[model samples]
Target: MLYKLNLEHILFLDIETVPESETFEQLDDVKQELWEHKTQYQRKDEFTAEEFYERAGIWAEFGKIICISVGYFTSKGDVRNFRVTTFHGAEAKLLKEFKNLLNSHFSKPNHLLCAHNGKEFDFPYIARRMVIHGINLPYKLDLFGKKPWEVPHLDTMELWKFGDYKHYTSLKLMANVLGIPSPKEDIDGSMVRDVYYNNGDLDRIIKYCELDVITTAQVFLRLRNEELLSDNEIVRI
Candidate 1:
């Protein structure tokens, strides 16, 4: 099925998010209460809400995307290049830029958005954040009333599952087992919040996110039984 689709028609992406504020105390009393209630099941008396705030970035309501790195393939004859770019800075501003990119470039019915665990995480998180910012949903991101088959989104994690809904796979695990290079170097998802909030290193986060995008595109190619991209084939802009 993957071989049937043109690689250029799919936009591969990864996002880095952090809690909206630096600390739990930054959230007002109402939000603090909601946070505690929202995470009760996940926390399960193991940690207080304040202690668990480090993970707030996983939830769109409590988090904001700091970077969105996207990559896409452009093939010329036998040669293929994967070009990646990142949108960073303020959440609303970056989201608007991302929405514009989707609306202008990837609005075609055949153009799909691809990500690892996207359906479960990245895709919905982007949509939810866009709505929160009052940004109109681009055609690619808006899924309202669309039949499952009509949704123009692809998830590598879902593809890896292949039918076992009970199974879950992290991107690193998938890359490792597939012999694709690991994207992680200085930090991982667990450290993104601190990297952004404490270290004040947006560039580092952007680099990490872009690497994930490249890795995701590589994983997709591997799944399609295609050749992996070489270092020279990856161009970041």
Candidate 2:
């Protein structure tokens, strides 16, 4: 089904996260206990909390966002382009900057933030982290008391679910299904932590994050049955 929302007002984004500490042993005593409790249902007798720490990035309380890449559609005359940018470095610092951008440009009611599996992952993770960082949530990200349909967010994976709560689809899977070019190679989600902490390569991670943003936009376009943007049309801003 074609989404009634206007394309120009949508902001597509993706993020990469890693364990808060380089290793689970680095967590303080209190946090260590919390991690064990938080992950018990998932790890249960198979692995200790420390052993499962690599996956901490999946939880906002134990993980932190290292990169947030965003893309938005802009038009010049008859040409439409998707311009991209990244906010990365210290998680709090980058989050504040991203919040500022939202407050300045994308806080309008007409603006909506979209991401793959965002409602369950990216959106809530960002909100929790912002609260921890003492940053106020931008109107678009804040959902307090908002009706279900009133929330200014779009989730591509959720759209594909068609009300099947048990369904799960990766961005790569969605891109391949939609005939959009995949942006994966070199590294996948599992290797992001090693690439960041061990390899010291935020640049590489940023590139990966940027490609996800592009793919997300492309996936959204496909949902609307619109033509994919030619490579020349994706401008990195």
Alpha-carbon RMSD of each model: 0.9, 1.2
**Lowest summed-lDDT stretch of 10 residues in model 2?**
1-10
* lDDT tens per residue, model 2, 1-237: 347777888889999999989998889999999999999999999998889999999999989999999999999789998999999988999999999988888888888999999999999999999999999899988899999989999999998998999999999999998899876567888999999899999999999989999998999899888899999999998
Cα deviation of 39 in candidate 2 (Å)?
0.8
Candidate 1 lDDT by residue in tens digits, 1-237 = 889999999999999989998999999999999999999999998999999999999999999999999999998998889999999888999999999899888999999999999999999999999999999999988899999999999999999999999889998899999999775578888888888888899898889899899989989999999899999999888
lDDT assessment of candidate 1: 0.93
Q: Give lDDT: candidate 1, residue 170.
A: 90
Candidate with maximal lDDT? 1
Candidate 1: C-alpha RMSD to true structure equals: 0.9
Off by over 4 Å in 1: none
The total number of steric clashes, by the backbone 3 Å criterion, in model 1 comes to 0
After superposition, candidate 2 runs with Cα above 4 Å error:
1-3
